[model samples]
Target: MIKRALVILAPGFEEIEAVVPIDLLRRAKIEVVVAGILPGVITGSRKIRIIPDYDLGDVLEEHFDCIILPGGAEGAENLKKDIRIKELLERQILKGGWVAAICAAPGCLINFGLFLSNKFTCHPSIKAEIPLSRLEENSSVVVDGNLITGRAAGSAIEFSFEIIRQLVGEEAVKEVNRSFLSNLPMLGSIRKE
Candidate 1:
């Protein structure tokens, strides 16, 4: 069976973090539902607008293999304030489904009391907000049990592959990576940051 994923998109969500996973998951043949937290078009932190596949209310009763949260400071705050997001996340967790968050979105997991003792990573700016004991600073992505967290926007691709690996398998990840030519390095000469 194809894996199904629900990616929650709130206004001010990080565009890359949201899009990369959705795109890659689709490429891997996972059914991705991009749901807006509100009724209409949602704008990203950089002002990119996207129409969601469904509104959060429309999918409240739907089942998914994973629930994904993309982070922006404002977006994460919006998610944190939504009782419905909390409820959905808790329900998914109770059913032993995967819960994934990136960057500041991990704050939502933290706020919802879902972080528990799970090791996770998030944007450096939000590190102080997460308990030091639970932070895994060395990796771009951290997966503990059914919980998956990514460090920042730059790590979105790697984070997404990890999600695919967990839901599908390493073989699926290799196939997707090959299709994207992700195994190949940059075409041009490397430039130092």
Candidate 2:
């Protein structure tokens, strides 16, 4: 079956973090649903506006293989404040689905009181807001069980590759990177090797 992903786009989401994963996952044949937290056109931190394929409420009852979160400082904060986002996160996990967050977006997970484990990474800028013991400081992308987290916008591609790997397979990742000509493919980390 084709994997499905719900990408929650808040008012100030990071454009690259949101788009790269959406692009690469679609290239890998995953069904991606770009959903806005609110209705109509949603604006990013850099003022890029997007018309989401669906609104968050429309898909609350739908089952997705994964839920993706993209971060901007304001975007993360916006996501954190939404009770619906929290509901989706909890429901996704309860139903054995995955959740991915990048940059400050992980702050939403942390702030919402979900994924209380000590194995995630977010942009260092938000470190002060998170407990130090839970921070995976060195990795650009950290995958802890069903939760996938990435450090920042620069790590969005890496973060996405990991998600694709989790949903599809390593071969799909290789094909995706090869297709994208990604210098940072979905193989074992260059930093770790």
Candidate 3:
């Protein structure tokens, strides 16, 4: 069976956090649906714009193996304020599907009371917004039960890899990483000029 993933995109989302995982997941043959909270194009925190495959309303009834949230301060705030996103998350969790959030996006999970007992990681700035006790400060990514949280933009690749590892497997991760030349030993034996 093909794994399906839904990635929610809000205005001012982090582009790298959104795109990197989508790209890698597709490479692993996962069906990724990028859904915009609003209609049409969504702009990133860094001013990058993306056209989502579906509007949130259009796919609310659809079932997915995973739901992902990419973080930016404004984007996370938008997600936090959306009742639709909260409902979807609750349903997804109840269905035993994966819930992944990165950077400030984890704030949305906290807003929904999903992180009360889960160890998670998020952008440092979000620590002030969420309880410090539940935050895993030393990890780039934290996976507790079906909830996966990533630190910040810098952890995008590793975050994606962890997601890939979950839905797929270590073999799939090895195959995908091999294709991207990731996780390979550096040729330190070669000297550069």
Pairs in clash, predicted candidate 2 = none
Each prediction's TM-score versus the true structure: 0.93, 0.95, 0.93
lDDT per residue, candidate 3, 1-193, as tens digits? 9999999999999999999999999998999999999999999999999999999999999999999999999999999988999899999988999999999999899888874788878899988766777778677888888888899998888888888888998777778877787763322111112
Model 1 residue runs over 4 Å out of place are 184-193
Query: Against the correct fold, how does model 1 do in TM-score?
Result: 0.93
Worst 10 residues of 1 by lDDT: 184-193
Q: Write the per-residue lDDT of candidate 1 for residues 85-167, one digit (tens) a residue.
A: 99999899999999999999998988888858888889998898789888887678888888889999988888888889889
Clashes of each: 0, 0, 0
Q: What are the lDDT figures for the candidates, one per model? A: 0.88, 0.89, 0.88
**Could you tell me which 10 consecutive residues in candidate 2 have the lowest summed lDDT?**
184-193
Go through the candidates in order and give the C-alpha RMSD of each one to the true structure.
5.5, 2.3, 6.4
lDDT of 1 at 63: 94
Query: What lDDT would candidate 1 get against the real structure?
Result: 0.88
Candidate with best TM-score: 2
The alpha-carbon lDDT assigned to residue 38 of candidate 3 equals 98
